[model samples]
Target chain A: MLSTQENAIIIEDLKKSFKNLEVLKGVDLTVRRGNILALLGPNGAGKTTIIRILSTLLHPDNGNVFVNGFDIKTQPQEVRRSIGLTGQFADVDEYLTGLENLLMMGKLYHLSRSVITRRTEELLKKFDLTEAARRPVKTYSGGMRRKLDLAASLIAYPPIVFLDEPTSSLDPRSRLNVWETIKKLLNDGVTVLLTTQHLEEADFLADTIAVINDGRIIAEDTPGRLKSRVGKERLELVIKRQDDFERAVTVITGNDLSHNSAEKTVSLAIENGVNEIQGVLNQLAESGIEVDTLTLRKPTLDDVFMHFTGLKPDEGRNEAA
Target chain B: MNSQLVYKKAYWMAGDVWVLIVRSIKHIYKNYDQLLGLTIQPIMFMLLFRYVFGGAIVVDTGTYVNFLMAGILVQGLAFGSLTTSFSIATDLQRGIIDRLKTLPIASWAVMMGHVTGDLVRNGLQAFILISMGILVGFQPTASALEWIVIAVLIVLFTLAISWIAAIMGLLAKTIESVSWLGFLVIFPLSFASSAFVPTETMPAPLRVFAENQPFTHVIEAIRALTLNRPVGNHLWMALVWCFGIILVSIPIAGYLFRRHGGR
Candidate 1:
């Protein structure tokens, strides 16, 4: 269990209103140390606003925030020294080279000359931009640019880093690389507050996930725990032929597997989970329905979000603003 | 804050500024043509004025080159400082300045670094204009120290204006408006001073306008030092002008940045 006191980041009763609309309404959260806390929210759920307060860039209209034991309102410098932020947009100078960006970030951290040099060399290699390090960032591919942004965030080795959609535009290869880097940060015991719309990213990387909608967190839990709360297993059946969909459903439900066929394939919420799934498969084979594929997997974050937000991840994000 | 604490703060603060500069320079290095614009324009203006304006215009100094050189250098420094404003606006638009909001560095360092870049940029503009000045017929009787003081003063002057321009940039709504914004700043400040012609030759009301304006003092101080003439009160007046701009624009820019700039 993570202690509410020992958590690296804590927000209590965070409230902010702009004229008539309230962006954050009495929000509370505790991000445990050495864990990746993915702050999942639709637009206007106040993710950026919360990030601003925790980074000491903005003060909340009401409530308090503590980052790395420093009160953001009173001890801004201490808080600043402790955290790293990579915003949703890449704010890097398009004219600067990949290597220059890291060195400059190193300079901001007040690293000595030799240390900056070593750190720069290390980041270039780590971010896999060794060849492109000297090229101006404007010439870099989108993946390379995002990696540079991520590398810049880590140059200081901050104990806590806030990454808002860090890998949104990255290709799968680069996205996986970013995931691996994030995993490495977890091993090093650095706390990460990540806000991302990519459900798969959250599903794989976040140890603790918070689903925020309408300026409030509707649900918060581990991926598996959150999935279990939906109260059923997800069984996806792929039909070998379009006409076989109805026949497969009869076999699945006949084995006491409750299911919904919303689209191309039929799904079931089964009992004894895998045992029910196994029985359905045997019956389908015996019935000669020629089912193409059958698999049993837990509900993903997408399903969990769908259950809470009443919309898919992309829909929730678009509708948020 | 104690001296040690302040130094520590400023030293760490320099990182944000330093990083911005290094990155900007790398940008400059990549686009050599942009730098070519810096060199090409003054050379064209030098040729245009010296050859065309040379035959008709007459100063007691006899050669039009001397008079033309000073004016070109002054105008180039003023114009060169405008790019700082453009770059600042671009950075703001691109969210580079927005990112700085999240750093641990001193709040003012980002603006300070940008103004310092103007200082350095104007210094380079000074160099190009001077080398071109000599290539015409302008001569300087002062030693290296005099030139250094004059150089520092020009930089300080450019920095003051860049601060003003930067404030305008942060406040501007769109990038297209940046050029117009810069133009608005320069139009009044440039023409109100002795940059174009001597104040004595102007009509009475215009002379008062020129004499009362801060630009006049800057031009007078610059002309006195570079031309090896007596500075008199122009030095004091120039300092007053530079200090006044810094005192006002820095705070105003900081305020605007804090308010509208992303948290």
Candidate 2:
């Protein structure tokens, strides 16, 4: 058992329902202090619901949750004092200038007016919003709005932060910029619980990835361990001709292989990376099965997702959308 | 010791409410179009009533403008209360309420801030409309004390209506739906009461409704106070309606806010 000081968040059999739909069915999760735990899942997998419950916005019908050693249900005010929430949407007043928004949040947190003024200036500079501090948020770009929202959350400098898909809607360049900002938070020893549908985001940023599906966390492990659990590597060959594709499929004896006739490619899950590729090429050469190209690929987060959920990531996206 | 803790809690709650009130007021200032509409609409109503409908109507009082003054002021307040609904609905739609809820501030502060902001705004509108009334041949015979009492009555009425508007904002699914819902409530109350004309001139059933409703009692209380008429049961009835609304609407709005207001 971990001490409360070492754990940033703990959920014991948390359950919630909206009408007849049970969004979070008896689930337990934990985040260690100063670590980033990414809730990696597709849409409507209850990722946002879990964040909502931990943030004290939505009440759980059953179970207990603790944030920074405070009970979420009984001591919500203390929990709020210890944590900041950045929701999926950037929740800032469009009519107010960026500086006013941060100052308002600071005041609500019970900071002194002088402290609010000082912190607002520091945060605006830190988030690269100093030039736009006096401009209303309605005129801000989407990325700028998100940056201001994040700045608002950090005004009080809480020990824990909950980010619900902080970069889900940003372009690639802005997404990378947000990633850098999150890394800086980690350097400050802030415990972060982030949710994202993008596999690369979880793989790149999360210390531990929790794969959730249908309101359940199917797998929770380090990114390396999760990927390795699915398999070692894959060998994919693009055959040059249609007749050779059929011959190549016949020569590869393993049942762990799949072929696409349109792409004229065969992908095989392999235990040995380099040796497996060599053996496959030699076998195809012997069978007069000409190969256009061959390459070895490591197991990606996508494969880990499919292995645990039994559904491709894109399929889950379509169903939820 | 217990009293000290209660005082401390009250102090912090007041602080939170004040901060949020400032935010709400800033929103009003920034949206100059809304500010303009608040001023322009009442002036238009005053002109239309003083010119178009002034000559045709007859009252036992000094003049038609004097009889129409209190009704116009109440009408402006009723319309101004809809801004409460619209602002609250916009906040909920934009997820601002959710952000406020997650903070460590008092839970009731958001609604209080919005309600208090409406009081300030409606008070200003009432002042403007009264000036317009005086300019258009409307006369008042009230003393200094009577003017103070009239101001208090107006404040209480605004508080009551603003709470109801807050409830509408919470219940309506969309901002557009909130306006439609507000119109459905405000249009009938302002029109069916003694706002635009006397209730005695109406037919049997309509006159009964027009005479007995809360708005009629409120408008009549203000009218009698301003015109130096005999103080009647209208004053007490108006107080009952105002307190009753404030008492009832507060809990329902608070309940809906806690249950569905997001975390």
Candidate 3:
């Protein structure tokens, strides 16, 4: 038996393979109670595989997973009782009304009839789906469907929830709406494990971010610390003339600068971006080099991701998405 | 786990199955056109065989319409149960099965719910065909008690075939494939058997295969029951076939349902 002090989820040396492709390779993760752990990765990086194993939707080839004090392999029913899963695609029945969907989930959870009714209303209202609650979900907008999916997961209020790319394929405004809904889960003290390829999503929503690549967690830390590992800030200079790029590179030397000849730009990692930009500008001005644009960029999760994975976060994602 | 906890879990599974059944039935109700189309096909077949082809094809039974009604009900129930495959395939495609698997209820509940719902729908289809048969100058000479037994037999046969449909739905890669698979099996079984035409009119080899199949026994049994004739060995054969299907398909459907995650 596990106590409440134990982590909400513990996965150790987890491995899974689908036919010829090895999806998860010896993954180890611990999500603390009442916190959000974002499994950040590009497409086919084993993020969904890991989420499926943890949620007991798919079995692992080897290793152990414990969710909310129960083993996922042997005590899957108990684990299921304690965890709610919102899959990548919305899982609510499109033929059922939004209210009926929630009620169905509540009944599946074995909640009493009266409690199911109350919770159904509460969740519909909480997700701001009260107006569309009576309509079949096929008539709902994409964002409404997502909200209903999330609400269905919360029907029983499980201590842990798995959001597998919950906001994928949604418009920007809808994505923000989902992000706000996820934020409310934090206040309710639910342990959330979300997967996303969106670096901005991880930076904004995750309390701890696990960077996965090639079926392994390459880096794991808070969003801020992960960004700091790459650099504090970036200094970007777009030279007006291609001829002046070589001279600008010399002035920006010793600052770990990289030049893109095609774009006529040079970027460098800097500790004090403002000071470094001023120094580079003065030096370039002295050499009679024209500058088109000069700016300091705060290090984003993309930089941290690239620094760890040696590939752009969006490199192999567009085709898959 | 404690016995009480196990009981509670079983109770939850039962409740979950009920919810899924209601959901499926409500979907069928909302798509009443599809239901109407399904129920109408058997009635049309009954009319075609009774009026259109009745004069040419002769059977030893008292009235050809009486002989055709039993086979029509069996064929209709078999075809009605095919909806189980289509609906299950749709649920698998839509990720509803994946969502249900993650819940605390028994995994078998998903398939059971589907079969149960199809069983109800099959019952309704049987009723519609029987009512139409009565309206078209057909009569059953069996007593009320035997009629009840015939109804029970139809329901049992439908329940068994539904398990097979569940397996097809689970094994199918696409929704369209499910329909094709159902057609591949149901069409051969219903047409080649004595559902529409008697086996004597067929060639000897085809006659042997048709007479030996489960659909022939079920149709023969239902024909005997409704005509107040001795059931002979066909009733036992029908019961055996129904039990055999349920015995073989329940485990296979459960395994395939578990295997086919939202893949």
Q: What is the TM-score of each candidate against the true structure?
A: 0.79, 0.88, 0.88
What is the TM-score (0 to 1) of candidate 1?
0.79
Tens digits of per-residue lDDT for model 3, A97-195: 998899889988888889999988888888899999999999998888988999999999899999999898999999999899889889899999999
lDDT of 1 by residue, B46-82 (tens): 8888888677765654466765666667667777777
Q: Per-residue lDDT tens digits of candidate 1, residues A36-97? A: 99987656678877786787766788887889888888998788778888857436767777
Q: Model 1, residue A152: what's the lDDT?
A: 85
**All candidates in order of DockQ, best leading:** 2, 3, 1
Docking class of 1: acceptable
- DockQ score for candidate 1: 0.42
What does each candidate score in C-alpha RMSD? 5.6, 3.7, 3.7
**Better candidate by DockQ, 1 or 2:** 2
Estimate, for each residue in A1-321, the C-alpha lDDT of model 2 and write its tens digit: 446888999988888877778777788888999999999887888898888888888888999789999999899899989988886743999999999899889988989889999989988988889999999999998788888989999999899999999997799988888787778888789999999987678878899999887777888999877666665787778999998898877888642566788999887777766776778788888888888988777665456665776566666633231
Candidate that would win on DockQ? 2
Give each model's whole-structure lDDT: 0.74, 0.85, 0.84
Query: Model 1 residue A200 lDDT?
Result: 70
lDDT of 3 by residue, B1-263 (tens): 99998997677667777888888888777668779989888988988988999878778787788778988899899988888898888888888877888888776777777788788888888888988999887788989988888988898899888888988998898999998899999999999999877898899999999999999999999998998899999999999999999999988887787677633
